[model samples]
Target: MARNKNRTEVKNYKKKKLTVSTSEESPAKKKKMSPKDPEDPDDALSKVESPEMKDLEDLTPEEQRKRERKLKKERKKEEKRLKRESAIDDDDEEEKPSKPSVCELSLQYLKSWSEKRKDWKFQKTRQIWLLQNMYDQEKISDDYFPILLEYLEGLKGSARDTTVKQAEDLMKEYDKSEAKAEADVQKMSRIREVLQLLS
Candidate 1:
């Protein structure tokens, strides 16, 4: 009877050990099976309280000034970064060929003449001279040329005759250049045909 009771007690003790071991192992296994928490710095920062925050509401004047200076420095850095980015954007825009506004075109034309004639007395004459140069160089697009010409023609003064004469002279020169280009093209075609015949 003593031997049988001892056997029974040993079996109960084994069962209890198994149950305790399983309970501990099960929690560990569950921990391994569960998904890991995300590693976001912002989340961690949000959860953590800064030491400065506790004293923020009751800051001494010196501490307050230091904090203000730090904030101002960060703001200035941000502003500088933004300014640099904006300047880069502006440079990109400048690289793209944008059509000149009428005012800009007119100013460019006037500037061209002003550079040539320092003592150019009359503003009206200067404008007319600029128009003549613009037409000659083909700086203004063909579509906008007539519009500019009309604007110049509407201006009444002693410079009107000089301006009209200059326009006529430029047109004649333009026609001659066009004729010369056509002749060159014809000559090239003739040479190409002769070469083809030889081949």
Candidate 2:
């Protein structure tokens, strides 16, 4: 008899606990599942229909024409705004001068002169111009001066007297500079060798 009473008490306790847990959960679930209010008419209309298309069939001819004109004006304004933005972007890009490639610089130099010269003359002139420009801009190191001179020497042709003279002058200048540099280097090395011997 005592065991039966204890079993009944345990079962009652479990039932009471379940009811308390369910009660606690009900309010939270109710908050989450609450009914939403009806959507605003303006929001619904904006989403599903544009002002231009709304009630078009019911409107008179004059009203329709006015709507059409308003749409056209808005379209023109949008187009103008886009064009203005594009112009500003182009101006920004132009303000920043990009580094020119050798071929591009050559073309620019050729375009600058009005008189037309022979092909070989033009090519030699272009090469000299490129070397000078690159040297001035510090784009080409002094070590490459000999290589550029050799390249110019290789372009020599009997086609134009003036071009050949110019190339020879440039070559002579480069050779003199290179010789001076070599002599300086040798003098420095000899001084270093003597210092080592003394040490």
Candidate 3:
């Protein structure tokens, strides 16, 4: 049997590994390393006024308010974006045309129907009122309420009083709801009482 040269093992002449012990650094290696001072005013200031420092004193009053407003708006937009993204078509639920609440749907129906029955100027006026109503949701101004009330009063001869009364009552209810909401908020807050007194 021939011994294969490729399979032959070489003699290992390597020294066995040893764990050498180390002592304190030599004078050459121990070049002067300074210790930090306990009471440097500049260092103290630098620590306090670092890039990540929460120094409201450095920021302008307007800048502070603007940052807060921006943060609030971003939070609101994120909430709205999440709500819109999560909208699901629930098939099991009744498919009766889903609307933006009864109040909003009624306002839209009235606006469109009134536009068709009446004219452009009236539609424009109604649209402005509708926009304000959507924003406020709680308050109906005296200007709009009286205009609507008068219109309803005049329509008594043409349309049923019951129908006109319902529209009039909706406006009245909106005003009453706003008043109640204000009262409720006042009752809930001691801060509001202080602010009211200051004003």
lDDT of 1 at 181: 67
Q: Which has the higher lDDT value, candidate number 2 or candidate number 3?
A: 2
What are the per-residue Cα lDDT tens digits for candidate 3 across 1-199? Answer: 2345322311110110011111232322111111136397655565455331233234456644544464346456655866766654344454767767644554554544545555423444554444335223244333333333333333324233434344454445554674556644432242232223222
Q: Give Cα distance to truth, residue 30, candidate 3, Å.
A: 82
By lDDT, the better pick of 1 and 3 is: 1
Kindly report which residue stretches of model 2 are placed more than 4 angstroms away from their true locations once superposed.
Answer: 1-40, 43-63, 79-125, 131-140, 158-160, 163-199
- Model 2 quality (TM-score): 0.32
The stretch of ten residues in a row with the least summed lDDT in candidate 3 is 12-21
Best by lDDT: 1
> Model 3 — TM-score against the truth?
0.20
Candidate 3 local Cα displacement, residue 18, angstroms: 78
**Residue-by-residue lDDT tens digits, candidate 2, 1-199:** 9999767755654554354342334333323322233376554444335322443334457655654565456456656988999999999878776798875666554444323433324555666665444333254434443444344444434523444444455445554775556545543343333223322
The global C-alpha lDDT for each of the candidates, from Candidate 1 onward, is 0.49, 0.48, 0.39
Global CA lDDT computed for model 1: 0.49
lDDT of 1 by residue, 1-199 (tens): 9999767755654554354342334333323322245486544453234333333334556654654465456456656988999999999878777797655656555544335546433455436445454433244444444454444545566555655555455445554775556544543343333223322
All candidates' TM-scores?
0.28, 0.32, 0.20
